[model samples]
Target: MQLLFGIPTNKYSSLIPTTFPENVSQLMKVFFCLHYSYKYNYFSISCWQSLPYNRPTFCELYEQINKIIEIMIYIIWNQMKKVILHWDKEIRDCERVMLELTIAQNNQRLELEK
Candidate 1:
């Protein structure tokens, strides 16, 4: 979902969803900002704009943002590992198949040479 000029819509309404989340409504706001920015990125900056920077920084709010970042990093690492493992297994299977074909060819050549 997305919001434009204070309206709501789906991802198909315009562009691909990819934005920084600063609002309580995580997915919706992220989509809205991304879709809106894909066209008018030069305009409208951030939700934190015009607000006092007196708010806590990531280091200051380590208990919050840091934990979220840690979990996200872990998830991404595991996903990447799974993809690598899957591809590696495929490569091993291909190698085994090639070896079997080579052995069969060699046996056929030996019988023909007899």
Candidate 2:
């Protein structure tokens, strides 16, 4: 399972390191643009679908909030990158865990769609 995270791996860390201000700003701009695009797309669709005149019921609202919390927690978790220098067995176990999670999510989504 490939991870989406921040810290560079140890061996070739300095290979991509940059100390330029312009490079930093460029990276920030790209990140913000991608962020805004995703945010605005979700908000625009959900906002129109959930107008107050035809607002969601209490249970629906509760479900929506729970979904938001789940997404936030997932994003927060992926932002953390812990460099673990462990045995091959431990790394394999972690990969298996991540694979199981991905499969579970896909199965759940399929069930919902059906």
Candidate 3:
């Protein structure tokens, strides 16, 4: 899953690092982009869809804001990249545990049937 402006989505909300960005202006920038993306294309990100905003006249404003601050996005992207890596590892570990549980359950069922 992916958020607006290409932020990858995680299965759990707690895994998302930038849910509450430190800077309010930057947060608004993100929100603006999200709104724009939601309007123009398919936005299936369940968590982000919950934001309360109606799109009317934010596209031009967002473009202006984005033009002034490309570097800020780079900084935020780097921070989110680290978090994403960590979450990926955690997700992999959880998947492994789930696979093991399924195998054990199957084995137990086989033994019971025998």
Candidate 4:
């Protein structure tokens, strides 16, 4: 969980009690302040379950982690696409401006020749 978010310190350390709460109220306080993603909070809490059998098996944990990774990859890909698109637009605008300036310079040369 700390890996997903960060290592809790100082005030943040208080959020995670010495022991897991029997109910979610204690956990809710942490989530409210941290504003953690629901999936991350759910997975972390599930792993912290009091009963070993209640917690996810190694295979289940692997599957859940993979799903989270996939979602993160998708989000990053979309953001990169947006950045690339913005760069493309800026490059086209710059090319258009350069062409206009070149045309103006050519007209000035023609007038000088005349």
Winning model by TM-score: 4
Q: Give the TM-score of candidate 2.
A: 0.29
Across residues 1-114, which tens digit of lDDT does each residue of candidate 1 receive? 344422222222222235435454463343345442352232212222333263345554455445445656887999999999999999999999999999999999999999
Runs off by more than 4 Å, candidate 4: 1-40
lDDT string for model 3 (2-74, tens) is 3343333322332234545568545444544554445322222233343324222356446644643575687
- Return the clash pairs for model 1, or none: none
Expressed as tens digits, the lDDT of each residue in 6-90 for candidate 2 is 2222222121235436875454344334453575334323422323444345676567557555766776666542324345568
- Judging by lDDT against the true structure, name the best candidate: 4
Candidate 4 lDDT (Cα, 0 to 1): 0.65
- Estimate every model's Cα lDDT from 0 to 1: 0.52, 0.50, 0.55, 0.65
In candidate 1, position 98 carries an lDDT of: 100
C-alpha RMSD between model 3 and the true structure: 19.2
* True-vs-predicted CA distance for residue 58, candidate 3, Å: 24
Error of 1 at 33 (Å): 14
lDDT tens string, model 4, 1-114?
Answer: 542333222122223555445575554454344334776666656664654566678998788767666866887999999999999999999999999999999999999999
What order do candidates take by TM-score, descending? 4, 1, 3, 2
Candidate 3, pairs of clashing residues:
none
* lDDT of predicted model 2: 0.50
